[model samples]
Target chain A: MSESPQLTYAEIDRTILDTLRPPTGGYWLAIMALIMGVLLGVACWVYQIFIGIGAGGQNIPVAWGTYLINFVFWVGIAHSGTLISAILHLMRAGWRNPIARAAETMTVFAVSIAGLFPFIHLGRVWLVYYMLPYPNQRYLWPNFQSPLVFDVVAISTYLIVSSLFWYTGLVPDLAAVRDKATGVRKKIFTILSLGWTGKHEQWRHYTRGYLFFAALATPLVISVHSVVSWDFALSVVPGWHSTIFAPYFVAGAIHSGLAMVLTLLIPLRKIFRYERIVTMKILEAVAKTIIFTGLIVGYAYGVEYFLAWYSHSAVEIEAFRWRALGDYSLEFWIMVVCNSLVPLLFFFKRVRTSIPWLLGISILINIGMWYERFVIIVGSVAHGFMPHAWGLYRPSGIEYGIMLGSFSLFFLFFLLFVKHLPSISMTEMKETLDLGESHGD
Target chain B: MATDISVIGLFPDEQKTAAVIEAMSGYPWLIDRVHSPFPSHKIFDALKLKKSPVGWFTLAGGILGFFTGFSLAIYTALEWKLIIWGKPIIAWIPFVIVGFEFTILFSVLGNVLGLLALGGLPDFKGLKQYDPRCSGGHFGIVATCTEEEQDQVIEFFQNQGGEVTIFE
Candidate 1:
């Protein structure tokens, strides 16, 4: 009687719950860090409110600061999450399930958090709403022709679409949670579950709907970054105005995004005891992506220089020189090493799967990626076509605080998300694992 | 505590309803679909399902999305126009981005409306009747049968099986 042939629904549910609810020792510490990060960030935002965008590193020539760069960097990092999940799903890649939801959530949160920078960068944060072109009595309207306007549209679209993609995947899972949780949680899950009954028909639509979104999302991943590139390309700055900027920016986004995923997940897998879910195989796949995208990104760098030389445009040439040999020359070289050279470590299969090495490479890639944006934004702006407008760009503590705080904000939401949802799609993983068992051995 | 029931079959279309139906023909049981999975185009063949109203919703959404996208684009561009010494009203080419985004935005809205129309969700009542294994890909088909026919179902399933389990 005790040994029934099939698992009772109770047992199946319990097993799933047990797997996700791994005990946490330093849960409080992680929480504390998130709180501190938020406090620092809020303080900085308040300061920006009082002192204006000037409190950060915005001056005559370089109106953009670390906030904008961070915005771009975080958005780039966020891209890989949905892009990875969608690509894998399209390919019917079996490895994607465990990683998809986490990746999707990451995209949603990072993109949303990154969305704040453009607003924060506004001198009158109060008047930032003016960026929106609402038809009202004031009669002022947002410029549709501005690349920044395009950015507003693209970023919002990416955010909304990616979020729907994320939340759609969670409906059935939420129902599962609802069944298990009680009282307030049960009520909350029930509401969020949106009456998902795990019915035959619902599953039918859900799958097809998710797939359609995946197909749509793939090009979007490319477009969002390309749109981001256009933000720079549309500008008259010699360094920024290149045709290759779109694809170059796209590849770099993927490169840096892959690196960030690795950096975040290495610690995440360990802390959550998801070693099995985020297996060595998964790490190897990530390493391969890093290598693949890194090559494209590095080529973009070289191409920037070559184009500068080939076009014989001295203004572009000067900007290129400034990127490599100017005061920020050290950053330029480090970008080369970290983004291009350091990623070479992934060439070795051993190092790719080594957790510590994976973490180091990822951090390097992230830094390199940040510097890459800095080169485009600050480098191009500081040493513009008109050297008369040239100026030094320095970050103030307020800028650093906001940047650090955004990181905290991202993590805080992500951490809570993990605890609440099934971090890995339990059902999807079991289906993959069960594939081998079906051989009737 | 453990008995493995394995089914190896084809998912000819999205929702894999056809796969489930094919399996059902062989075993007389009450089958439950775990959750909706991807590859959508198979609603008719798999479960003999009706077409979704998502298209209608999508159309409505597309219209709404157009207004939202265009209004935002036009208003923003006009607001504090950087009067670049007299550049053309920030060319319409840039407005295309907003248009493209609105199209997709409305499409998702259509999907949500379609979902709500199909079923006002958070189905606590119906959820209790379903199985988690549905999400796991094993459309669990529970056969309520007498002892005599049990072995035959088992044999048929073995020839066409993967991860089969029995209760009682």
Candidate 2:
């Protein structure tokens, strides 16, 4: 952990509480804009439902397009939340104290948004319940042996567990908010807090419960993305069928996830004036971790090419070659430059510490990660086994609109989260302050 | 029957509150509960509480979840008896993935349920004695006493440099 910020317990409560006071005109305007974007996406989805799945640009050999790409991309974005909150907590990293709430909130919102893509991808959105394992008159149960089924189960579990973990951590802070709030707000928080009194017994069980949830979330986060990868890996498509897909996808997920964290948190810190709590030191540590994940992502790219050649599989070689130098080569190289090259800037201290550089590079990484999924999902399928079936794919305007809506929805939820709840873990910050004071004494 | 009263001692420092609890160890039952803005290992040690059994809840849920997952997959597969692509009727590998997800899902649910049950949460009664300052910087120790011992308890708290409030 970096040097503890000089903050009193009361000050911590006051500052965090101040963030929840009221939404300003600017905040409302941002909300209005996001809602408009969400409506546009919704309208496009409705049009697609009415016109049939043919409304999108997906065609034979490229059956999976932007929807699947968005699904995988958003799922990847959710990974760093668990990494920062659960894994860091287990490691006892104190720097995570300030950012953990936001990351975990991001996880819940991102995963929720990611959950929508599969449904949107299902053109007959109404019959989506067919994926559920229920006995019906038709006597059909979802194929447990299928990777898609695995995704449904894994992602649902991830959402539930992540929600539980996030809510568990929020309880004490909710109680603090309840205490500070009045009238309707107090009643609302009182109910939300479930009447938390922070008694010794409550704390004892609460601590144990939080630890258990974190422990569960660690493996759950890993498995969720692995299952998402299996959706492609289990296929016989040349570029998709790789044993290294799980770890490669996992690394890429965290890489993008950390970038998204910076992208959101940098602006958040500036707006909320959380500079004291979310110190530069913490951001630097995050950047350093990004470098590690980024290298793994870069290494995965090299290994994919190496293995394609090393295996001497003609189809795999063609699939990879077409990815880099074919119709979608621009996206492939962009993914490479943005994900692998952009993050390398963090190796320079000036880049890591500079907010503009960090924000810019992180944004590039987000774009790169999105394209990374696009390359892997669309690029692989577009040029698979049968040379006669080889074709190029491009997203329709509807697809683009829907993707825009998803981004707006994600930011909207995050905005609401910051305004309604304690964005920082007030209880944890107070504990840190108390400990720091004692140490100084 | 003698009416019982509760005397609440609010301390500014958690360490001082913990010390008071330790000094009054001979009358451990007198310390009804200690409330703080954060979890205090110091007070927990002074009180010498037992470890929580929430993990057992997690273990039970995990075992149940594994069986539930495997059974659901196996029964459904056998009921159909339909084979796909020459794959086995009961594929354990894919079923393991389902089982693993369920195990985590149920375990987390169990952990939360246990937390609520063991913590006696959703108890509005506890809030009556709760000082909002406990959520800020103060540490409050609530103790139960007989009418005869109320003065003695207040004096004890006052002697420990605590501000005392008596509730009848």
Number of the top-ranking candidate, with lDDT as the measure: 2
Provide C-alpha RMSD values for all models, in order. 7.0, 1.9
TM-score of 1: 0.83
Residue B11, candidate 2: how far off, in angstroms? 1.6
Model 2 stretches with alpha carbons more than 4 Å out: A1-5, A435-441, B1-3, B27-29
Q: Which candidate is the best by DockQ?
A: 2
Residues B1-168 of candidate 1: C-alpha lDDT, one tens digit per residue: 222222222221233444555566555543334233222334335555665545566567767887777766666666656667686655567777887778777777776666666555545565554444444333443334456656665555455443355545
Q: TM-score, chain B only, every model? A: 0.49, 0.93
Tens digit of per-residue lDDT, candidate 1, span A258-284: 787787778877876665456667777
Report the poorest 10 consecutive residues by lDDT, candidate 2 chain A: A432-441
True contacts kept of each: 0.45, 0.79
TM-score (second chain) of model 1: 0.49
Query: Per-residue error at A59 for model 1, in Å?
Result: 0.8
